[model samples]
Target chain A: MSRALLEVHGISVVFGGLRAVDDVSFEIHDREILGLLGPNGAGKTTCFNAISGVYPPTLGDILLDGARTNGAPPHGMARLGVGRTFQIVRPFSGLSVRENVIVALGGPRYRGNLLRSLTSWRKKGIADEAGAILDRVGLLDVADRTSGQLPIGSLRRVEIARALALSPRLLLLDESFSGLRSTEIAQIEELIRSIREDGVSVLLIEHNMKVAMGLSDRVVVLDHGRKLAEGKPSEVASNQAVIEAYLGRGERGNVA
Target chain B: MDYFATVATLIVIQAIAACGLNVIVGYAGQISLGHAAFFGIGAYASAMLTTKAGLTFWQALPAALLITMLLGFLLGLPSLRVREDFLAITTIGINFIVEAVFIYTPFFGGALGIGGIPRVVVMGGRLGNNQFLALCLVFLVLSLALCRQFARAWAGLACFAVREDETAASSMGISPVRAKLSAFVLGTGMAGLAGTLYAHYARFISAGDFGFPVSISIMSMVVLGGMGTLFGPLLGAMIIGILPEIFRPLIDYRMFIYSVLLLLMIRFQPGGLLGDSSLVVGLLKSLKKLVKPKNIANPREIGGDGDV
Candidate 1:
């Protein structure tokens, strides 16, 4: 893949009188972890949604590996190696741990459909690949159990596993750390390092400033659907606009 | 004795049919009210092949399966974009369209219906009613096992995840629309199997038999059984399938009691019987039983109650 796996340029989304995300442009370099940060309603999610194809921009383009993938659906993007995890982890609750990954691992890129896949099993090493994916997710232990029975933290990891099984070039994590205990958050942080270390470009949106600041190679801050600051975490953390956005006009110094 | 055996067999057959419906309604949380249409398609496919081709019943069975599967896949097209009430409307519409086709088409015998359906014979000779019933029971067991497997398998889990949260499931690379449609097609295909069996066993078929009431009855079975459990559909089908017959002495009042029972079941147990029995619930219940309760309640554990 190219060094810049995804180049999201000039993207904009408007809601009546409000601009949810305006002229947001960012490049996700290959094998790097970038963080998007904003307070509640900062258009961080709207921007993520646009990139993920949940919301096609009211304006502008997104290039996946230098090809315009602007209006592609999630399935198409997934097929092209763009995988994502939800802020609220969605493990097909009724499904066992393995099937969650199986769909992504068995998409058009892998097993495809029923008839073709029936033959794929006999071809060579397909079962081993599926087993490998389950093992990678740490879900191999609960591979037989219903994913729904899991607590929120484990479901979050399942979401990551299912995404990873897609064999993505770019992984977008939406609040991957939200709602987890510190120990659970630590496990995810470690997993994120390993995943980024494996050459997948990651765009993570997080409200937990410490986690975002700690892990991000670079952090971008937004306010009222507009980019307020984008730079190294230390620099963005100290920026006047970002400080104002987080702490309001006169309280910027107090925030530190 | 014959009546008992037949009821038992019919209960198993309908239970299998209801199990398919339950996959869509119960596990995936989509309501499919036109399931009878799939059943009808299967029945017609089997009937046509046996009569027109002079094929043995066994030979016709697979043809019936394939045709109904095609019908199911086609009927499933509308579900690719809709769910809940809209999906129900589409299925209901398909049922009526298929029913109209059945009642009017010269090929399907119009209102005169089709007959002379050769009895299903498993071992070269015509199966006695009891022997035929055993085969149906075997199919029922296979169907039930298939349902349970899918319900708990990745396919079933995707349905539940989508049912619980569409956005989250999609983010995990599972398109909700695609997952639901697959479930709908598979569920309808099973309904076709049920219809094929019914046609051969009954030796005659009519459009009027596979109508809206039957669809409602199937939905009633899934809801009555519990929306997302292995035993729910079976239990739901048996109760709905046999209760009216049991109360036949009440004449027209049999249906009235059945309706009241359905209403009470929904109100008292919204998730159906097996709905509340989640793993967490089972574990917690067991844990609670093992511990003695103390009277002191902590007020500080409240979360977000004060937020307006």
Candidate 2:
């Protein structure tokens, strides 16, 4: 196989004495969807944070498209086409919905000449660009509304939309379907699938098994910060160790 | 007429200075109570350069801006480590330090301050009040235009993003430090520019002119006029800078009234007069209703009130 779009190799994150993410390894290829599944305290979010550069891994390397990106800051991750959503959605509350997306779009454009960036008044195109992203996320109707006024469902979509505005080659979605209704989750599933169809790789951290099993091309299970299993969704879901780890080696309780 | 013109000139100068404070306080969401220190730096720099070094007004203006901006950058470096309440206290300390340096140091004429700041002359003729007011207005318009341009620029958006949330801004590839420092350099430089204009226009200066109270007043302009709005600071400068003079008979109660107005503004309308609050929209809607002919109503709007 060709090179993976994102590679996590022997990554371990230590918070004081406790290893938050212990020797986790994974590889996500181009246009692929990899579901990261674990119960609470499984270190899924920790792994995501390490990968997205909120905090660096204590050991091992993160490779984005064959380039070593270990220890890069969040802004550096963004510049390298790695976009992510917060698990606990952080929208720019003071800004309008469209302005949120526009601010995200400003990420790469910040590299422009200082004087040119200041004096150039050709902001004529940025609104249209933000509008287009909002349209894709079905937020175009409420584009003028303040982001803080939106319901949780719409705010989740706005978070995704803002991440997409980065024009990322790889998108890291942290609990995108959490706190969403069934219908909202279904819509987000479709959106995630469509994002993958658009040639953007997805690394999804999900507690919901149905969406994870149905949507991810591959699944990696984490148990106490260790990689419990990794394979095709069906294979990993049926693995005896995975089943035991999830259901405590008792009756075959429903995963969902 | 001369008195009115002088007040107008002072308002214009304060408006320019207020715009600088607005960028740090409003757009970048940073606290700066020592803004008048930058203004003092500019005024002192221009005054000394003109009187001691014999540089012309134009030459001294740029030098003053550069010197003040450098100081602003240096001062901004330490503030970056702290935020909000701590930052405010740090700026207050800076204001006191600048005041003491001017008062105790004889290089800047001690407490008396440098005098005889040469008048801005064109074609070898001293400018009259009208001409000088016209000059200040030109600079005011240029400064306002610069601010408007910065607000719409990518850099400005980054500042806004940083102001909203630093982590989120960084995730979107904006360096919060760079955005904040840029705000300080630009905003403080503008304050310095305003100082240069004030020195030349007033034809005299003293350390007492730019002190802690002046910094508070400048901040009050940004807060009262509406932080974050383009024209809010200018509107604030007019209200706080000139309105008090209008009620000069109640000079003892000026600060008290300002305190009441600001308190009411913060309590009822945190966004300021023209801030991003819906109060302005509601007020405008009411004004529009008051102005329009009540008989001529749109058919589609009969049952549909546009209130959100």
Candidate 3:
């Protein structure tokens, strides 16, 4: 219905002789949520890495806002409005929660020019902005606490908050729901919905079937590094190939 | 009095240089074993500018800073590509190469070093030892202020982020290259400032003064004082700089003592004396517990014998 915020066109990523992700294509429109589903070692994370510029694709192109950005460095991609989080949380453990967000806020300022960065007053303004973002992410109470001391669920929120600090047009969340409690998952799902409501498109890699099906506007499944299926939840659920991929060939006939 | 002033001036100079090294090693989490090379470069550049180019000491100061910082930027560009131990080895190699250049290059005085460098001239008069000490103190304060500002700045935060995780830092849009290069450029620039002051104050220069040993000594000052803390380098410089003079009788065992002290620090207190989790604070807490027993019923039981 809207212009695509991100388009991954026939992208393949190969590490040495192994094709980690082979010729996968997808599109996420403005304010849309796209769930990329796969079994373990299905190259889902590799695809995310290629799109987020961690590893440039061995073939094909990635377009953000219709601009070719397949080979930019990770930070270059971030500055161009592609934000991301790791599957394993990476928090600046020594720094406070607020400071972690502040670091991200300062990133788009052209490597923070020496003169401007030296000004102490600007830090106050940036801290205020960090506080507001922390408030939005519900991390305000523990803003001064070191991030390393935070629990896993809070750390996941910190990862999300840090990515949100980039003010990205496209947010690539790699397994944000894993290792979270059921309540935490519900909260994160609501947070993701709000983030999309605020006009940021989301591309999430999820292992949880029900949540992925419930949350994503569209879903694409990968099996053995190849696109297995793509459609709405109900349509994709009844697809013979996806059933066989998930439940095995003999059990597919029993699914009605 | 003059001897005390000289030792104080030397301490101040070393402290300034240590502060610079801390910015790179402490804040940015980059190990540089070639910091003394930059210091020597600053000293040499200032000395040559004043003696050969006929520039005033004041003029040579900024020129030396620029020269040293430029060299730091160039060196940082290639070294930043490597991580951790490889980067450390690269810096160690740089120290050796730079020392060799100073020794063999006739333009750098070929081991003898540049001499007859002009001193600070104030109000048409050469500054006395005390006055020179005062000047160095002023510079030390300036260096400390610069370091404090850097610690509070966004660039410093970026350095911390880069230190924590380069991939995450890049994902957040902070360039690891920029964070590290700035640390190098600023750190080496401060080293240059210290060198310029040292050259003018000492009234002579020698290639042996800025060799690998000096680099190790500066690094020790940062580590011993508490890497990343503002006052840590100053404290470290005081101890390391004054120890030799205080223990002149045992000068032969100087390196031995230093090695022992460093070993103890690393093993017992890796955070250094002033770092967040320092031994000093741990000792203080234990001392407090000893003095005002936390459990009255078991005052003599240090381990809270009956609580469990």
Candidate 4:
């Protein structure tokens, strides 16, 4: 595999008295699809929050392309080519759907001077690029619609479009298809495949093992804030520790 | 030439001012109780230039705008991560500081206030401020149109997104701070421009002229008119502006009557005059079934308006 695009080493987050993520480490390669699997409260989302800079990690080193960016703000991360989507799909409700993608693409983080002379020209270019990305994900139809008015499925896709606009080497999608329908999930899975095809490494945190297995190149299992297992989809699926944690093994079930 | 022209012109000016405030307070979901401070800044910027620096009212207006925009951008820094009561307090504090500067500063005319401010003239025709008032209307229209366009643009989208959810917005690569800052700056600059126009036309200025009452009035116009809609600010300003004028005959009881009216309006009509266009659309769609009765029943069934 190529040199690690994202190297998260010895990351830990302490909240009050609880060690939310204790000594977590992982690597994602260029053009790779890394699946993160863990039960509710298993620290999957918290780890995502740390990597995406939503809340900085209390401890550890996060190197994106060999540059340490542990505690930098999320916009700083975006400027450094780290793009992300929220698990809850928080879109700007007052803005049109296309505008959401445009905002992501044509933000101050990447765009030129605020009072540039040829802003219209730049805006047109940005709009074209944003439109193409949205069209790729079949979200062009809702381009002019206000984001708050979109259904759940469209909002998830809008989040993906926004992330893609960043043109990031590392993209993290937090349960991108959590509340999506069967067809919507399949559409997103295909989009994920296309994103990987574009040489963007994606770390997807998903509860849907079936979808994760279908879309992810490799799976890493976490249980109770610890790395339970990691391997190819089938291998990770067959792992005893994962099965015990997810399905509650014979003695464990009886104990419960 | 006539009082009708003056009042109508001022209404248009205030309406434009309210529209500017709407972008920040309405669409951006920020509560700026210090909007008038910006107005005061604009007035002073223009008054200082036109009276002391020997610049034309037109020239000083833009100058005032540029300075006010810089100050607004600086002030918006606190809103980067602050929320709720803290945000409100910081903004109110900014108002007080700016107001204090105007009140205590000798050049701001201190207690006596700035007078003999020149009437603005353009093209040497000497229509003076009435003509400049026309120009202000033009600026107002331009601002409103631009704001409406932005309301439909990614900039507007960024504002609403941050307002609705900050964390999720940041995750989507939308910087909430940047969006909110832009909104705040745009809103304040427009307010300042309005104040400058008022100063130039009225030929007088005072720190007390732009204070809490003005800020409250601007905010109420936005809320009572409708928070996010383009037309809401102007509509709200017109109603609030005229209501006070009409209640002038009530003499000593005018303010009391105004307060009761405002209270009743707030208590009964929080959504203002224009609430939800979509909800209204839905209601109309349901009502339309009684007429057409054809097999068309989904409002979101279409792709979208596509107006941009």
Kindly report which residue stretches of model 3 are placed more than 4 angstroms away from their true locations once superposed.
A109-112, A121-123, A250-256, B284-308
Cα lDDT tens digits, model 1, A173-196, are 999888899988887898888888
Deviating ranges (above 4 Å) for candidate 1 = A15-17, A91-110, A113-158, A180-187, A250-256, B121-124, B148-153, B271-308
Ranking according to TM-score, highest score first: 3, 2, 4, 1
**Candidate 2 or 1, higher TM-score:** 2
User: Which digits, one per residue and each the tens of the lDDT, describe model 4 over residues B1-308?
Assistant: 66656776777778877888888877788878888888888889989898899998778878999998888888888654688678878778878888888889897889778998987676775565467667877887887887877665556666777777777667666677887888888898889878887887678888888877777777778877877778888888888767756766765775576577668657766666675644444568789987878866555556557653
For each candidate, the DockQ is 0.22, 0.62, 0.60, 0.38
DockQ, cand. 2: 0.62
Candidate 4 is scored at a TM of 0.86
**What pairs collide in candidate 3?**
none
How do the candidates rank by lDDT, highest first?
Answer: 3, 2, 4, 1
Angstrom error at residue B20, model 4: 1.9
Q: Give the root-mean-square deviation of each candidate in angstroms.
A: 7.9, 3.5, 4.8, 5.0
Considering just the first chain, candidate 3 attains a TM-score of 0.95
Classify candidate 4 by CAPRI docking class: acceptable
Per-residue lDDT of model 2, residues B163-245, tens digit only: 98888888987778888999889999999999999999888898989999999899989988899999999989998877778
TM-score of chain A of each: 0.90, 0.94, 0.95, 0.93
Please report, as a residue range, the 10-residue window in candidate 2 chain B with the lowest summed lDDT.
B299-308
Q: How close to the true structure is residue A138 of candidate 3, measured as C-alpha lDDT? A: 89
A1-256, model 4: which lDDT tens digit per residue? 8899999898888899988888888899999999999888889989988888878888899999898888888877886788888887778776777777776676654333454411342346767777799899898877888888888889888888888888888889899988889988888888889889989999999988899998888888888888888889999988878887887867645422
Models sorted by DockQ, best on top: 2, 3, 4, 1
Error of 2 at A169 (Å): 1.5
Q: How many backbone clashes does candidate 3 have?
A: 0
